[model samples]
Target: MAQSEHLTIPVGTVGSVDSVGAVDSVAARMRALDAALPARDGVAVFNRVYLAVTEEVGRRLDAGGFADPCAAAALDVRFAERYLAAVAAAAGEGRPPACWRPLFQLRRHPGIRPLQFALAGINAHIGHDLALAVVDTCRTLGCPPAELEDEFDRVGDLLVSLEERIREELMPGPDVLQIADPLTHLLGSWSLERARDATWTAARALWALRSCDDVAEEFTDRLDAAVGFAGRMLLIPLPD
Candidate 1:
């Protein structure tokens, strides 16, 4: 087993506004937009969508609770960390190595640099850490960790070359996904659909990671927050 550290679980809450609309409503719409997604594709896209969701919701809650309650803020932080850890672990463990195609495709977008520098740093590091985790897991499982290890090395190399690659853009542009789909539409710099899908899947996968009897209760126990970073969410006013 890998050397372990104690994990702290922060307390967070979903205010009435967050539980109903900010979270439920947005999540529903985002799912609608992603109706056509393949399950496998969902996994690949999870981290991107998740970071976006946490950043977006976190912003809303932060604004609403800027001076409200510490418990709520703690809850949001815990939720964010749990989701990220799950996403990172997923990217770390798998049969064949997962493709980075989606990630690379996103990189070509016009806003990549700024998005990376700002709200999406978690994605980059989680991505980097997860890629390495996959290698480590593969080694433990007695699988050939060569390809994954190489992939990890490639990303590690790129991470040193730039800032955005060092972190991820919180979800793709709203144009990148439409969680609301045909039922409704989503448009903005960030896609609400991608964010929702990512959060759901990451949480689900993270929750499912334990293989032993104690796995369910013990999983994510090793999770921790990324250090020294700032994240944001925006509420834009569109001009008619």
Candidate 2:
């Protein structure tokens, strides 16, 4: 594994606004991360992938792809804020969510390929953060998860589409994906579809438990740990 290091901006260095209704803020954060990280670093690879997805979401929103653009913007911003907060927290010597810890911790291992880093980050963010983001959006909009389902689906679709391209762009080769390869098996074991299904379920469960703070806390903690475990597995160093 790579030496442990933090890649997030320092707390208070950037504005702590909860969400970004405008694309400028999210774009700025992406640029900051891009500038701060080396291209070969695992976190940088994942950040590039995620930045593209976010930019596409912004373009679609501007083109009126969403029925409720406001809700979509809120959900998008809230979802991204969770990630940015985790990075900032890590940078400030504070604990980040378990799901994010592995990416930061294993960022520079030579044996771990870029695709692994990107997919592992996606696993953690979508599995844990996206569910919580849904809840956060509902709270911000004074509505329930049902009200934001459309936006959630739309965003989820974008992520799914990106996953396909990520695989295509980063996969070693068609022959390399054969079952004999460890990377192939590792990549095959995880599916974005399954993760998205589980995220939606978790979001609904969180919404149901919003009234019971204690239960919700326990549930969220478990989700974080579970997603983190998956991320750790995905980051296993592979032979060159």
Candidate 3:
């Protein structure tokens, strides 16, 4: 049960209040993820890498003492949006949008880079607000997912930076010309491939967890191997 003191809802805001029911849903979702993911038993670690990291983003939004996930998530979104706008304005050719785009082609990846820096601030706030159980579970990470609420905000920031860089430098973003071999990217000047790999591995694990139905010994064995690799991915510094 959540502590009553922690349940205090501040007044005067549009979405200040929270209910016990909403909180239960978040906990249930996490349990479902924990059970579903461990089922693969680890053999197919990389199989789900592409999809998992993006979804696991939630673990950061509802960190400590959040009785209402909606409230927690809403707060996170607002902070991220505001943070992105401010930084993008400073970085962009002085233009900041209500929402900044992330991917060069897709919808989620950030187009700008500096926005990522401001986002780090917002992430800390979310981490501080997480529930006790959630905090304990992810305690191993010096700065866990719960601390990264500004992730989306950073994405927006990057978009603005990209735009500004294009206008000012008349240059292409990040690595303008594509390399013949991706391995070159992984091992190139300050290769960010390592971070990309980590995100991919973690995302894969999440995808596998989200998809499983069978709960057997073989499944458990595979899940173990998958997590072992995923854990190692997290340890490597982002290759920038």
Which candidate should be chosen as best, given TM-score against the real structure? 2
What tens digits encode model 1's per-residue C-alpha lDDT throughout 1-240? 211111211212333233323343334433432343332233324434544544454454545733332333333343343343433343344221122222322322333333332323334334323423343334333344343333333332333333333233333456743565321221234432333334333334443453543663333332212111112121111121
**Tens-place lDDT digits, model 3, residues 29-105:** 33433344322212112112211321333443335334434434443333333322333342334532212211101
In Å, residue 118's CA in model 1 sits off its true spot by 4.1
Local accuracy by lDDT, each model: 0.34, 0.84, 0.30
lDDT of 2 by residue, 56-125 (tens): 8888877889898888877777777777788777666688899999998888898999999999889988
Candidate 1 residue-wise lDDT at 116: 35
- Candidate 2 has an lDDT of 0.84
- Candidate 1 vs candidate 3: the TM-score winner is 1
Stretches of candidate 2 exceeding 4 Å from the true structure:
1-21, 175-177
Write down the TM-score of every candidate.
0.24, 0.91, 0.19
lDDT, model 3, position 97: 24
Note the residue pairs that clash in candidate 2.
none
